[model samples]
Target chain A: MTRTTYRWAALFLALPLAVYIAFVVFPLLSSFYYSLTDWNGFDVNYNFVGLANFEKMFSDRLFSNAIGNTLIWTVAAIIVPTGGGLALALVLHERGIFANIYKSMFYLPIALALAVIGQIWLWIYQPNWGLINATLRNIGLENLAQAWLAKPQFALLAVILAWSWQQTALSMVIFLAGLTAIPQELIEAAHIDGANYFQRVRRVIVPLLAPASVVVIALAVINSLKSFDVLYVMTRGGPFHSSDNLAMFMYNESFQKYNMGYGSAIAVVLFLITLAVIAVYFRQSAQVERLYD
Target chain B: MTKTIAHNDRRAATASLASDRAQSSRVPMIIFYVLLTIIVLMYSAPSIGVLLASLKSTAEIAEVGVWAIPRSFELTNYVEAWNGGNAGIYIRNSFFVTIPATIISISLGVLAGYTLSKLKFRGSNALFIFFVAGLFFPPQIALIPLFRLFNDLGLYDTLWSLILIHIAFGIPICTLILKNFFAAVPTAIREAAIIDGANEWQILTRLMLPLSLPALAVLTTLQFTWIWNDFLWPVILIRSDEMRTVMVGLASLKGQYSVAYGVQSAMAVYASIPTLLVFVFFQRYFIRGLTFGSVKG
Candidate 1:
């Protein structure tokens, strides 16, 4: 290609590159800079309070709870959904009947906007006449029923259950793909060696499908950490801020409370934590990168 | 060889297989059906319950158990909700913000992705890595600076502000996904186009863009779904009721009508319809698209 053509291609490239740098890259750097100062969001008269916001973050009770809940949310988001999804996928795949119906049903919640899900579950978690508690009581398990999103102990867990149901469909899809890729010969071989279905799954299927499992788990964890909509809607990080994740805390501090610096500090910490986990996950899955293609 | 193994076990295997078939068929099918039904109930309960409640009067909604049949099917709840809720305006606001954001983000993403994958430019790897790292950075961190940035630029409270934010945040991951897609395109085609004395612009426009239709379609749907459902940026950036996106509008509605369950449920269902239609249309490709943006080549 001559210089003229090369210049045209570069011109095409320049438009997106300029936008990317201005919006994404610029804001990120500015946020980092703002984390060092005490700027009330709307104020014009603010000075750099070096390390003060960071100091407050270290000692803040809500920040600590947010971090702890964020960790729990991440773990439960990965574990609970992953187990349920794989189990569902295994059952649906073996049956090969009503699979499409099941898949569509499972995926319904994911398609709904997060606000809608939050609103739907808010009613479902209503303590007195809510379906969950009422159903338990109807079954003569009255003691088992609880105020799901109201109490501090069960608030995050209840939200996680809702999220797990919504998210697991994607995991199931990934698992189904991985399951299809596994050579059917291996499963037949295991069956010939006097293995039952359970044994074949354990011995032949799980190990071969480890990559898909990792991808699902990693994605779930990241998504859980980034979750804001439901928590923002249902609880607003309330009942003593027990439901507060890092994302919510950041929003409240920066926007609601008007503490931009402290909020930026919290946001930075959350970013570091996410990056660390992803880094570790990638390192562990190095041998399988070949399979990604 | 595979057929011979089955042949060797003809008699004993036939008995065993018959027993296996009988046992597995009757028991597991029932168990599977039960389990699947339970799961379906779990998933569909809230949505169905909400829809039913929305159709019921406030009194009936309050009196009946969530799963119970409504005493009467009343359309007033939906009619009143739409009028009082200003949902039509909110829906329009969402379209205003979502459409431009989706187009700009996808277009920018495709360009950045195409350049990085197809063209041998200086610092492409570095730029791509930067974008990948952008994925890991929580949007919370940037909210403050962005708010200030938008305010200073006098772009606050408008759909354009939200569109810019969405495009900016979306590009990194979108570009990452598009880069992988462009990489997967056969280089031989490019070489063939080059041999025919076609310049990069003509070749990319006439050749690459046409062949890359599947990726373009997938990216468009993904971006459309994402922008339509976005909550945080719109919520923070657009504070006025008139400028509010549907998510924020729903949030405001929820707060206002916390006691009015029927009205709120009706509104929730209203906001849910557009995304539901998109999901139904792209149901086959939804899973692939979701995984494609986040995962590897």
Candidate 2:
């Protein structure tokens, strides 16, 4: 390819590049710099504490709670969406109007904002007249019904279920796309070789859909770890910080409690974790592209 | 190369229904229907529950629960949400934020993407990396400083701040997707245009943009949903209720109408409609955009 010469390229990229660098790049780097300082949210004068902000985390219960909850979130992200998506994808793998309709039905949840999903789920989990409680009562399990979000024990799980509903739809769509890419000949051959449907799925379909599964799992981890919307709407990491993931905890600390430095530290920790995941995501996605391409 | 197969897949989907039905056994077909029926009901239940609740009286909702069939089909709940509930203002605010943000970001991304993909320029790779790096980490890392920056720039608590932020951050995915799409166009076609006395601006606008309408549609639909559905940025950046986006408005409705389940569901339905409408009408483009990076990934 020939170089398109000096001024034209510069002219073309100038505006977008300027805005992007000013907003996204500058703030991201500044966050790392600020993570070392003891700057309260409104303070102009602040001291640099190096790793001291990071060091205080060992004794911080809320930090531990956020981390543990984030871990639970990450683990759930890996399992639920991936498994459910793969299952749905397999069930709806056939080509037809029926498949398309069901596919869209599953995909519908992903189209809604997490805030809306949170509201819907919040109603479902409401104690007195909520769907879960009402259904539980109807089935003769009145004792099982309780305030899902008000109690610390069930809040995170409730939020995760709400989140997973959307995520599963995403995973299903990805898996369906992956299933589409797999050559029909292979599955046909497995059937011709006397393999049953389940056997064909186990030996042919699942293994062949590996690339899609990688994307699904990676996205689950990424979206879950980075999640703030649903939690913010539903619990705000609340009813005693039980539902707080890193992002929510960081928000409460930085925005509400005014622990900007400590919050920035948490943001850094989150960045580091996400960086590792993104790195893996890029590698796996690239490898998947190569394998599929 | 992949596009050909994708095209064939679409064709196959529309034409292969009879063959697909023939290949499967009666038992498996029954299982598929049963499974699909159960899953469809399960999947649609939440929204249906909310929809039903939105049509019922608050007293009826309290008496019958969200799951129970409603006796009252009240439009009063919707009327309340639209007028008294501030959903009307929030919907207007959302449209203001989403439409401009989506259009401007995609336009700028088109410019930057064309340069990055089609031209050999110094620092192009670095520029590409600069934008894409925005996608690697959570936005929380940038929030505190952006919070300060927006305040300093006096863009805080307004639609402008949210719009500007969406555009700026949107560059990453926009460039990533559009550049890859543009890169697939035969370089010879661009060279031919250049040889025919066309300038860069003319070629970009006349040749590239027109050719890439499908790509633009995919990008537009996705960005619209993302910008419209955005909650976190608006929640933190805007303080005033008048400036609130639909999401923040919906959240506030929860706090204000804690016992008014019908009102809350109505607001929830309002918040969901724009994105849901996009999905309904542009299902192909919506799915294409959602699966774009994943399949590419």
Candidate 3:
């Protein structure tokens, strides 16, 4: 408010601004520049290839596969986590036996790193004597159980399931918080108006949970788009890159194959998609801000 | 704001409607229980199996199915993981990185958040957006540039690389949390303090900081967990076994000890324990932080 305070403001803001610009803002802009060159991470004397990297992605089969897998993950991200979280939040919204413990049990995965989650599910999907096969044999459906992560057809889906385990927990917690904000009187009012349970939930609860859904769905979309760690730990985008999303694809291209330029192109594409989704998130969340106050 | 949400949820959970038809409630209640049972099993079964398998030899796990009870408890699995598997060093490196990073980031974030919240200086909105925009950008976009930059600084393999990177990247959420929080405190107190000749720094350190401990707790728990569990940057940046975070070490262990299932499981448990402690003790703060940061509650 005063001249001296304005000086303090500058002092306080200076450090964070410098660090943020150095680490994040500068590098992010540089990624676009680097994407246009043929830098293989070692040579200081690479040519500026001017959109060649982006053009190469047009015909790359593995790039196509990565996009396909990303589509699957993004679609699954929209449906599975949203559905599971909403269901759990609704169920947990009502009191039950050991409700607190159940809530913790589900939320526990969210705390663990995706790497750990990948390991746990790796054991669960191990071909021989693993949990899936063991249970399948016990139930006399041994044919149904196989190496879930090894099969190219199943590799991406298996990894998606493991990631969904953690993400679903996140969604559930957000929805539970959303559920708290709903007025019970609205639900009760509908209940007394001859509306069935499903009708009341459909008309009152779900609609009112709009703010939470925006957040949960936005998170799911972003998390799925950033499908690197879990896939890295689980499959390494393996069984011949069947599980490769843009991140894994980029890593494999840049780090493993030493194609940093192409990887940067992929990164640019991934960044653009994420930027669009986040822009939408900002708009929708603006509405949620209005709804709150 | 967070208090009302928690309070309202408690009431919602405990105060079920009495006017509901018994028949209408019963079917879905049964369905809910069934789904809950399935979900509980889905969440717990793999973990329980991993725990069981971790207590036995790989040979023994193969002899009996992984879901089978261990014939003998091999507590040595943890030792093997800790020493033979190098989890001990990984854990040390993680703590060395996570603790300093968390403390430094929170302090810097508070400074930025306080100024951005109350100072009303020119270009403050742009500065705030500068940090907030970081939240939207994917880490991949910065990978090549960052890798080269770190090498240039000669901090490539050292822990400082991660500590600085985390604090810089963590600015966005940290500022958002504290800014939203400090903004909520009555401006009259700030005005009063100003009239008393108290400076901005004094008001923040004495008045705002003490009043905003809850927000700090939320930021602390969330930031600590996130930095501790981070994998992408660590894997790319750290080289020596001595410098790898526990998550990167776990990934390496999986490659080196793929046949040693028991050891792998033990290391997985070791990797998850710290975050589990955060979850166990700060469950309330953890959930609240998640909502407040993302949903801006």
Off by over 4 Å in 2: A1-4, A286-293, B1-24
Write the residue-wise lDDT of candidate 3 on A163-233 in tens digits.
Answer: 99999999999999888888876886686577886898799999888888998999899889876899988
lDDT preference between candidates 1 and 2, better one: 2
| Residue pairs of candidate 2 with colliding backbone atoms | none
**Could you tally the backbone clashes for each prediction?**
0, 0, 0
Per-residue C-alpha lDDT of model 3 across residues B1-297, encoded as one tens digit per residue: 999997787566445544344545788867867877787987888778778878988778667756778988987789899889998899999999899889888888899999998997778888788788887777888998898899899999999999999998888888988888888999999999988989888999999999999998898899899999999999889989889999999999966887888888898889989988988998899999887643334
Question: Per-residue CA lDDT of candidate 2, range A215-239, in tens?
Answer: 7898799889879999988899989
DockQ in order:
0.57, 0.63, 0.63
Model 1 chain A weakest lDDT span, ten residues long: A284-293
What is model 2's DockQ versus the real complex?
Answer: 0.63
Worst 10 residues of 1 chain B by lDDT: B288-297
Better of 2 and 3 by DockQ: 2
Task: Say which docking band candidate 2 falls in.
Answer: medium
Instruction: State the weakest 10-residue window (summed lDDT) of model 2 chain A.
Output: A1-10
Q: What's model 3's TM-score?
A: 0.93
Evaluated at residue A153, the lDDT of candidate 2 is 92
